[model samples]
Target chain A: MRPVADVLIVLALALVAASSTAAVLARDPVRQSTVLALLGLSLALLFAVLQAPDVALSQLAVGSALTPLMLLLSVRKVRRKGKEGGSHRNAGNRTGSTDQEGRR
Target chain B: MNGWLSAAALLLLVGFAPTVWGAASGPVRRRVMAQNLATLAGCLVLLLLAQGYARPSYVDLALVLAVLGPAGTLVYARLLADELAERPARDPVARALGRAMTPLAAVCVPLVVLPLCVATGPGRAMVKLLAIGALLIGGNIVSTRALSARHATGHTPRGTGHTPQATGPERHTTGGQSGAAGG
Candidate 1:
């Protein structure tokens, strides 16, 4: 029974590691936003386990909600800019058709 | 090392880990569902943590998570409707989210809170726990419905069902503006 709590901390840490890596490695902006949200979740869990509830609270707010909001908003703005540029050139070009699609 | 801590750990491993993987690698809808699951699991884990560590104050963490988690997922669903509505991606994730919010919430909240209530002996703390559990389950249900609504309507305008050709960037721009307002 004693070892199990330690295992929890270890697993939370593992989750943090795996999710952070995945957040960076993710491709699509929308999907990456999901990974970012996951990263925030695990990180908040880690903070809670370490006995820092205050820090964990802030982390929960910023990590889970705000970060995803900011990331998705920025991505949306950039995508909109791209679409406006495309429609400028030719009305036929919709989303995912911009030449910059190969960037990331 | 206690029963609550052990339970929390086990729940995290079994329930939360898969969500991480699901959110990390999948289609947009799948990731959204996984993120929703992660929030539910995280809230439950925090409740266990509160009991495990013997700190009534810690339950506040779970309470806050319960409120904010679904809010975040709802925001994701609204903003990313275009991507999700691009095509249905066979969302087992959403069904899993329904499970997280419904049956899991039904099972875990009462199970933990009841015992915690007994332990706290019908005080203000017990009241707080009950309230948190209610809020968690209620918020989860609302968020689940909102997330799945786009899938139901196929993200098209209500009256425009007859015209497949009407889905141009202009329509999406209007949709995006409304979504931004909602966000």
Candidate 2:
């Protein structure tokens, strides 16, 4: 049981490291953030394995629930801003042509 | 034994894979959230460590962290929102605060190290201290940078600041006009 526990701990740490690296490395912000949320959930399980129910529950509440929600909110904010930007680019294209003709 | 651990470890892996992929990319607002996820995973690992050692203290720390986690993130998000909303003008105080963090870390290291060396030998307590310090510093940096960025970009979500309730795009036009006119 003890040896198995050690293995679980190692594996949990590996997952944490991998997910964190992904969160940091991913190109798409939304994807990265979502990955991050997943990482949090995984950590919650690891806590459970460690036999700390209190800590495990806290991980579930904060890491899986609250943290992810916050990330999602941030992602939504970014997406809205990006959509607004797309509109700006389209507007620029229309006005740009006018300026070009004026310059000529 | 292997049964519970296997399932738990597998879940951790599944959760973490995407986060690492994201982090490799440039830092962004979302990246901060992603890092938080990773931090949570680390916290879980710490919980397991505590359980394995039968230490009540580790569980207590985890509980504290769990509460702090969301609160800290929310604060950081608000700061980031502010940074994006503000103009490009940099606040000297913010810059100074940012610079101070490194020195503070340096000071903290010795304070932690001296006691750690005397009491527990080179063990789990050292790891705990490092984790705590990292989490706190990481949270602080995320908040401050976001605040500064929001300030420089003037790109915050609408309705963040206090003003009379104005609805729709027309409200922005009126509000913006008034703001511009006022300035």
Highest lDDT model number: 1
lDDT tens digits, residues A11-73, model 2? 656766766666666665444554655566556646656566676666656664466567667
Q: Per-residue lDDT tens digits of candidate 2, residues B1-183?
A: 233344335434553444454334433443444444444544444444454454547545454554465454454456345222432223343344334533443354345334433444567665665555455445434443444345433423333543334224534554553343233
Instruction: Return the interface RMSD of the candidates, in order shown, one decimal each.
Output: 1.6, 8.7
DockQ of model 2 vs. true complex:
0.13
> Which lDDT tens digits does candidate 1 get at residues B22-134?
99876677788788878888988998888888888988898889888988988888898865665454556655564455567668668777877787788788888888777
Question: In the order shown, what is each candidate's alpha-carbon RMSD?
Answer: 7.1, 16.0
Predicted model with the maximum DockQ: 1
The CAPRI-style docking tier of model 1 reads medium
Provide the TM-score for each candidate, comma-separated: 0.81, 0.34
Model 1: CA > 4 A from native: A87-104, B93-101, B155-183
Clashes of 1: 0
Report the C-alpha lDDT of model 1 over A1-104, residue by residue, as the tens digit. 45866787899899999999998898777788999888888998998888889999999988878888888899878777877776442233334433323442
- Candidate 2 Cα errors over 4 Å, as ranges: A85-104, B1-183
